[model samples]
Target: MYKLQVVKELHSSEGKMILDVDISVQQGSFTSIVGKSGAGKTTILRMLAGLVKPDKGSIHSGEDIWFDSNTRKNKVPQERSIGFVFQDFALFPNMSVLENLKCVQSEKDEEQIKELLSLTGLTALSGFRPDALSGGQKQRLALARALVRKPKLLILDEPFSAIDQETRIRLQQEILKIHKAYNLTTILVSHDLTEVLRLSDYVIEIGNGKIVRQGNTDLFFSNEGKTDQFRMTGQVVDLICENEKCFAYVVVGTMLIKARVEDSMNTALGIGDLVVLSLNDFNPIIKKIKP
Candidate 1:
């Protein structure tokens, strides 16, 4: 289990504010932290990763105390068992993909490096540098490098914000696969609400440098009055047309939802199309059709 209670002062575009947060996450659980810009979402991740110091409280995982203000005990970033993927790929421009992963270790292990390359589907491009790879591939390499240490906790801050929608979805699936295969506790900071809802088992909503709410994914998405509308992304499984009205069957994660399409919108939809499904007043509306 992971326990965190930390406070820090931050200065941003919103001015100075105290980031006071308290939350607990079970081991091997996938949690996403969501908030507007400068709401301290990234700061929370940095504190957990030992990249930033908190003014007060403590952070503990299992029997390991990562940080405690009372005793002035704090582990440096290298001392903490954490894998962090930053918003940018952060790969070494001068090093090849294989070299990047090898650099993480004091002593290189060829077998381990090869395994990570295969796991992240970068085996073919191991000889290439970050500049030669696509946006998706660079992010994948970053993930591989982070996992070289076999960290117990994985922290990602807006890792997919730069990628295209198709690549973003693919990377999200890759992240889930990595999380389960390694059974690592994962925390993601993302502004993409649909991506968060789709991949996270739990969600933490922060506002004004404080934790406004934290709960299961269902509770976070199902909560009413939080917004005027909610958006979800899914693949079209079936499409039916009757007279001027059309109905679309979309597979959103494990749940299948039907969305009604107006005649004017019917010309833009088809089976197997990836689309955004919005909900308002319990009614499904399709928007932002993806090619």
Candidate 2:
């Protein structure tokens, strides 16, 4: 088991907040941390990575002690055998895609490098620099680089936030595949609740620099009232008409969700209209507005 007990004080724009958390994670579990901005989600990941030290606490993985406040034993990032994927694809600007993966390796293993490049779909663009790759490609490179060391724990800090919806979904599927193939203990911090629900086996909710809740994904679904009646509100920005289908471009928060409109309600919706959108299983249902 991976055990963490932390008590730390953080100063933010709002004020000083205490982050006190006690959490235990089973090996090879995919866990996600969800919360509003500045809620210490990333901080937890950083602490686990050995980049940040708690004021008073200890982190242990089975028999290995990663951090212990009383003993003053805090292992460095390199010693922790952790793979971190940052929000900003922090690849070396001077290095090529292949070089980025090779740089982190403790030994020169050409076969391993080639395998990772193929796994991440970067074999075609292996010689390209970071600036030349698309957002999705760069993210794939980052994942490849992180996995180059074959880490026991994988940490991701909103790694998909910058990508488009389609690319984000694809990468999410890729991450799931990699996690299982590698049998890695993965921890992710994301603000996208839907993505958290889809990807995480265990979910941890953080607020005000503290852990608000932590449990299996079902517990989170129950707490969020996500029954069969899951609905969200958005504004109709534009309408796309094709063949026999009408798709409404709706702006929900920062996400522009494409929802299909029923024929009965097609003429009822217009630009700048507030609408309710629901997802029954995978099909989208756009509620008719009472205008």
TM-scores of the candidates are 0.83, 0.81
The alpha-carbon root-mean-square deviation between model 2 and the true structure, to one decimal in Å, is 6.9
Go through the candidates in order and give each one's C-alpha lDDT. Answer: 0.86, 0.86
User: Worst ten-residue run, lDDT, model 1?
Assistant: 220-229
Q: List the residue pairs that clash in candidate 1.
A: none
lDDT of 1 by residue, 160-234 (tens): 999988788788889999999999999999987667866799989899988888889766655534223488877
Q: Give the TM-score of candidate 2.
A: 0.81
- The Cα error of candidate 1 at residue 54, in Å, is 0.7
Mind giving the per-residue lDDT tens digits that candidate 2 earns over 63-164?
Answer: 999999999999999999899999998999999998898889988899999988888999999999999999999999999999999899999999999998
lDDT score, candidate 2: 0.86
